[model samples]
Target: MTCLTDGEPSATADTDTDTDTEGELLLRVLTAFLREDVSGWRTRSTPVRRGDGLWLRLPVATRERSRGAALLMPVLDDGYQSTYAARLPLLRREPGGAEFVDTAGVLAALRDLADPVDRGGFEAFAVECQQELDALRLHAGTRREVESLLSERYGVDPGSWTGLAGGLGYDTLAARADHPVYPTSRGRSGLGIAQLRSYAPEFHPTFALRQLALPREAVTVGGGTESWLSPRAAGAPALEGSHLVLPVHPLTADGPLRDALRTAGLEGRAYLVDCPGPDVVPTLSMRTVALASDPTRHLKLPLATATLGLRNRRTIKPGTLTDGAAGQRLVEAVVDREPRFRGVILHADETRFAHAGHELIAVLLRRYPAGLEDAVVVPMAALMCPAPGGDRLLIDHLADRFHDGDTLALLDATLALLFDWQTTLFAHGIALESHQQNISLVLDHPAGGGGSGGGAGRTRLRLLFKDNDGPRVNLARLRDVMGQQAPARTEFDDRRIFVDGDRPVLDVFTTITLHLCAGSYAFGLARHGHAPLERLLRLVRERLAEAVERLGTAPGEPGALLRAHVLDAPELPVKAMVTAGTLLSKERSGAADINKHYTTGPNYLRHDHPRQNYPRRNYTRPTGTS
Candidate 1:
């Protein structure tokens, strides 16, 4: 049963509201500032005598504005400050009064708090934040209308949609959700309001894919795509002499790709096709889209937009296609060898595609395996989004279908599957960037073959993973498992993918999987009163302990290090997403890769407090395993 009452509000209410931008933005910035302990916030800030919850007065050195203080709610698994503490004012200390501050004021205070001030970075970040707020406000009304429509169409009668269509529908809902940590995630730099509606998934726009014809000798081709680019397909234009067809995103065809052709002196040789290709709709990733006629075939094209940060452009770099395919091959080999992972782990066939060896011009086709028309696939990010009308979460619908509305049980089952797969991969020396957006949960039709949505209670859970370009690999450990002669390989064009130490592996596991995927849910559920934060965190630890026992926690083993780093450590690593993703340059941030910078945060799994002394279990190998 769902723990929330009919009148109760959703955990995401603060972030989803049409107005109240200031309050939501304040919470987002404050949570990041405090959780990251930016400029020694934890050590320097003093606690206030608040009656309801913990509040702190931050010492921001600013002459233009008054001092600011924030109210924080601590999560139990990781010390991430809660982002849903709504109606809590960021108080400004004035001579005769204290009043709430605007979002700009709050950001300005935060900018002042930084040591060796980064005025330029903070100013740019502020601009993005305003852009994000505008976009969020612009989307607010349309988002509700879309959610209502989806609820009426699918939520009431899910059987109407096939599994793939339903998955894309859920992806549209997920597109409305914000990133857990990044405050300016909604900021799509270089995109105007019209472009947002035209190209963004949240708008649910369906437009025809554009095409360009390049010289046959000037392009690089990967897998076979003759059928996709043939003259007879989708009324494609007849190719000129010695030319190959290239599918391009509508946004890129007229913008950066056109510029790229001119820069490469191929404008005369290569020309844009006047006729449109197949109709396609954007997915959660924005750049990747599925065909309107055949949902199974997806095209991942390079778009000329920036999300997350100005520096993070959505373009495919040279060699990215081959490297992504290689990563997929490595993971597929591991799954084939491990009996527990055989049927439950799935991959999209990304071996077919072509690019012009430029970031601005490329396309990768991802083909889903056949026979998914009768399953329910939901992205992990969509699970927590408020269902239509904001009464309960979308996960409640699944809970009602499978667990008799037992949301806690659904969460438990999900956590079990996640830890089992993640820790097993860790043991095998692979660290997937399994963020909520990249991974989706596929619920198979119940035994006896019923409709995709309405089925028996007992359905199988499988994970569908895509975007294989970001996983980190411990090459030496993988060699031990696959043997030196095995064809499985982790070699990629990106140097950051290979790591020789346990720290990098642990960093990815804890930050992406544990914090973003698991902890985000736990904290969200607790905020909605589904379960206590401690109880949910205990469930996570228990599941992790079980995985550790199965992997065998002997000294110098993977499990031993995993256990020590995740469970027994005093602090866990958290990605400084705002810092590295947007705020600072590589020189200023001192980060080699923009995505890899981290800061140590308090570990909630450890119980060193005087009141609590949870017993640690002795981990040993399970019999007949390994």
Candidate 2:
């Protein structure tokens, strides 16, 4: 059997030029800053009238505020920067006026800012953020080096390389893996630069998994079937009694996990089997790995890393596995019951294994949607990733499929599917966290081949959801819809689903899926001059209107209530990451408390103010009727 430390280098050799590495570091920091700004974490003065656009002002004295403003200077377009600079009296008093505070100047200003005693946690967060930035920069350099090495050895351009002839390629996966906005949000805190390169999807490294045998008594297993537990034994002896096979990521195997196994008295009882087949490829989520031989089956493993301010460890509590199993059943029932949601694939957890009360060794086995083998499946984030050796976004690759390369048509198609799928799920009492990474898009020619090369009908787009852990159901409403069979409680009974209001459900779905996912994508398109942000939002509104009509809700049904909420709500609740970070620091909370942080923000979808004599319906009515 191959040991965890066998045949691997301890540290990566540094070959990157200092300038390039520093530039990459700056990009990572700026991306995080941009996320905070767009998410409404930073405060800005009211817009003042400018030449063509409105001008925003930032208080120069507030060093905390200035840090975000300064970072924004580098990534934002000239027009945006100018708008922020215009009419700022403080900047006007500085040398060379506002124009002098360029990207470099902003960086310099940030360096001069001092940390306050009250912001000790923020100071620590800043250090971690910088470390993550440095790690990502190193990862990027390693990718380039690997690309060059492969190119020279294989006599082909690796950057433009495609995988398996006509199938989906690694290029798309690689591009999407390195998140454009927050690449280091999921940095492995304890990992060195070389280990980060080894495990991170951006570097495109693959390695064999280490296997362990857990006696049936020591592990709590939940799934539809036991067959899912089959493992590639790789010469390891079979257990004398009932045992569940667990395949662990190599990094986890070397750390605390190995020590845990030894402490559990599994050293002699469990065989340390080598993975015999192909290596596992990490996906956009560093913890989830897909088998190289079979892409359809993915194994979600716990890792000792943190991303987006949440630790990567999956095993936290005991009831979570039970909740996951129950949630899967509930989602499967929804898909079967709703015809509009038939195409919405929930990559349900087929199996789960964990020691009761000990979540350190937890693992979930999930399968790709059935009958989608030929479809070009990619994470929604891939649409925003830059194409190979070009500034063009990956969505540009699908331009030929639409009429005159109309991006609006593509947006329309995608939004329509999203609206239908999400609305149906909401109506059935499930709120999906359909963020870009959790959701995937499957693009293909329409099922019977009717359209020409340049038309709206040429290609079809379908939405597939992963990470079933995100679906939350309102048990009260769920029982109203599903009758006696509906589950009254699950592991996530308190946290996952809203217990009282439809507005909270709508808020969660809209914040994560609409505002964050669609809004970010629209902003990216607008930033690149691909499409107008207003037009995209209008399309979203139109699609929501259609979804309401499609569901044919009466005046007071959940469907109608959600539709009204989407169309008429004055503001939506947006999860405040910065506030959450502060709360996390102050409370010293664990990762489970991450979702509890939210603050209200303006609803971009609602363009019209309330008018007298307009119909108002109660949102508190029971599920089905007016």
Candidate 3:
């Protein structure tokens, strides 16, 4: 096994193969359909008797359509047939009933669906989806290999290593990056398999960053204090003169940016000077790389990869860089002022820069919290990831702390922290897109011991948020809270800080945090038989209600509006990626408005029964042989 440390580069080896096979393409489409909820399919189960043993048979279904083309007609009606047609075999019709289908019968049915005449204009989308799916599967295989290799190299059982190794963070992050719960784009990365292995965090790939030293006047720097950049300059002596050193991703050095660097009057033939410090590895967010020497400082470099259903170029919009800086300052101020919010830390983007007309070179700098070294920070998405060498979920590792492996206890601790964070942000009129990737849980084990022992006492779980660019602030609330402390620029045009309407601003936070973050986790846990979906939803409602009651104390408090919206509103705004993709397909000009696409759906919190009706149950061990 290859042993690579942070700030050290591994020799590149070619492992490329043709990934665009028919079976692989079909799997990708099936995964995406299951993940994005494109046709509103739900997993339903029926009891079946087989030879004297009774079994619960679960099948995927949609309203009015259960099997055959009928089951997929709704998706086709939505103009996604081209994207889904290749994967139809995966949903084979049952012998007698049209409802239950054979999900495992995909390979045999691959050739059954030839180029159908009905798929007229969507042929291109279908092709792209298939290609992307194939690429995704290839990456998934690489991820599995990386995990297995890391487990073996460390001489620890897969998924059981609890030490705070620098490599462990990237290993777990890479494992979580697979986003196993959602089938869509499973393991599908924007970079190819070989590039993924070389540069992606999952593969534990590390390489020295190529540096570009440009005259200070050639680039525009914004949003950072002079002290922040001073430390960064110490590592690069090439920038000794008044030049600023910018780190470039290794892949970017070999790609389109090469020409741009040459034009900018760089020395080397490759147009990038090799920086001498430690190599950095990419995180779950492909663009953000953490230093091997110092885990606290993370450098966000520009990599044009189409992952998570969006193509990110790492470039900040015209004035948004300054806006991000101001937002960070405001959040810091709020955190300092509010005691309840002090637990949550927003990893602000301290600095942002772009070379003149070279937005591709833009980078954002962020620092992890100081004095929290022992804490194990895991992305929320990784909690449900399958543990290596065991059927249990990765989150199950924390179960030793709870009574009788009661996962609900863990859920409660996480929710309590999330409530404090969310409520504080809401009260301040700031909405964060706290999805699984953007949010991390800092699990502070008890002081005296480690792992299970750490859980014996109260385990403190706090929320740490990154990517400060997306938070939407309400100008009205800012003025009320900050008073004279508000930035002077806010007086001229509130548009810089505040979004247009109150509801939209609130929607950005609620939809992503509540629906995408909590909702997705509930479904994932239920899928793995760890906990019932309703149980988790009920817990969420209870926590929200408690928060509402506590915040409702002061008259004119924003909590009242939030309370009503969460409890009484019939539907909650959901960012529907498939619906958004369809809308983007219709546009003939300019870049797609990927962020604006939203669809309202039934709120899970609103229930007909009184809150007390669903009494909390004791932490009984899950059913099966003890």
Candidate 4:
């Protein structure tokens, strides 16, 4: 059923003796078998041999222009013989063994490398055209039609308060005319409300939410645009939401997060916010709806993990795409492109809070349920997934987030943790793309743990990673619809409607990663680049003897440490945003007092780019879905 390999399979010459980084060797090996250019390509190898000398194989979807990429899955022993007899190949082999194509063919052979030795004491060896029953039975339903049915089954107005339009079955990422964010009785339409404060500077966000602030005026910015923000938990002094823009360096004692919280008077009561509106009054504080719960709250992402096979890459609509492949590109920026990076952790059910105004900072997660520090990872589920579009970062190292081990230290100390993080991530074979916007750095009193006392009340890093919404499950999956093994299937490949290039990886990352990582890297270059980048470069230095230092220290799972930095948010202009902003300001001040405006600290930039026309669709054949 695959659209690849017409008629009899084509042949290729044997060319395997190449000396290079495992990355290169793997690519050549993968290429020989895959037999076509791959997109969202990823490579992983053991830092050193372990256990029965086995290497874990992982992959995401295949977004390439040719062939269908599927996570060539792993199967052991004679089990695959039957699958292959039915034409399923596990493409695998020994460390110094032969290779071939077809998922089953490749993986089955690779697993055999770990097989037990013969009675003579040498590794068992032999290749057999083992065949099994010609009938394994095909499923009754066509996989592609499932999404169509799910969308129809749900129907609009299935109406749970939690339900909202996120393009699940709409066939487009950004809304279209019939789609309902805005009703046009007009020519050009805007998706979000323009900031009312831009015009009505005196307006304040409001709603009865206790411990919150609201714009005073009833004016709505940009048509019906509404934004929400939460003040820091440590407390603020101001008691009014006076259209104020506090300086990051602060010209006064009270800081923004604290000031915003105080002005909103949220220190006292709890308020519920489940309103209806194009502009329901703003709720500038945590809601009684509950913040972090005793039970971990979770938010599933719109992104799917790395999948294989060429997804329907024909640009079908006008908004940024939000499938697993797009997410994989984001992840690659974080895991493969140098410095290590991990993604954000959503509150048990806090996917909504992660992206709402003021709720985006990692500092907010500092309010985790009391005893959950040691329980670093939490899975919170919700109706909507909120991973910012693209890999671009908009960091908010809130001024209130400046204590000892707080956000500040997490930034500086990011270097010391990359070793375990990068290796763990490559193992997953897909990056988590845990950029700052998606994650939080919580600071609390140390009931116990190392440097517990010193970082107490400041910040003791417990790096968190989540968001299955946008995963590049594994490299193999990117080549084809990785069957049913993907970590999570997407609600829809709605984001593809917006991707513009022949390959989704380049376009998505160019926009998202450039935006996010540019800022982070700039922060580092401005702050401490040598350390973070070197963390990886050093691990991968001259002879890699560096890994020898800690023979047994790799984290159990890839992305285990999930440190979100340049490697984690590479598409970002990690070094550029900081650079551009600096360039702009220098010109503004004529370079007279440049140092006054610039700093090693990452300045938060959170501008929400609205959705536009669905780029023209560029269709290839209907290969298969990832």
TM-score for each predicted model, relative to the true structure: 0.87, 0.75, 0.73, 0.27
The candidate that achieves the highest TM-score relative to the unseen native structure: 1
State how far residue 411 of model 1 sits from its true place (Å).
Answer: 1.6
TM-score, cand. 4 vs. native = 0.27
lDDT ranking from best candidate downward: 1, 2, 3, 4
lDDT (0 to 1) per candidate: 0.70, 0.54, 0.53, 0.24
- What local lDDT does model 1 show for residue 544? 77
2 against 4, candidate with superior lDDT: 2
Give per-residue lDDT, candidate 1, residue 290: 91
Lowest summed lDDT across 10 adjacent residues in model 3 is found at 617-626
The pairs that clash in candidate 1 are: 1-405, 1-406
lDDT of 2 by residue, 573-598 (tens): 65545334531343543324465455
Task: Report the lDDT tens digits of candidate 4 across residue range 358-384.
Answer: 221111111223345332221111101
Q: What order do candidates take by TM-score, descending?
A: 1, 2, 3, 4
Residue 455 alpha-carbon offset, candidate 2, angstroms: 7.1
Model 1 residue 262 distance off true place after TM-score fit, in angstroms: 2.4
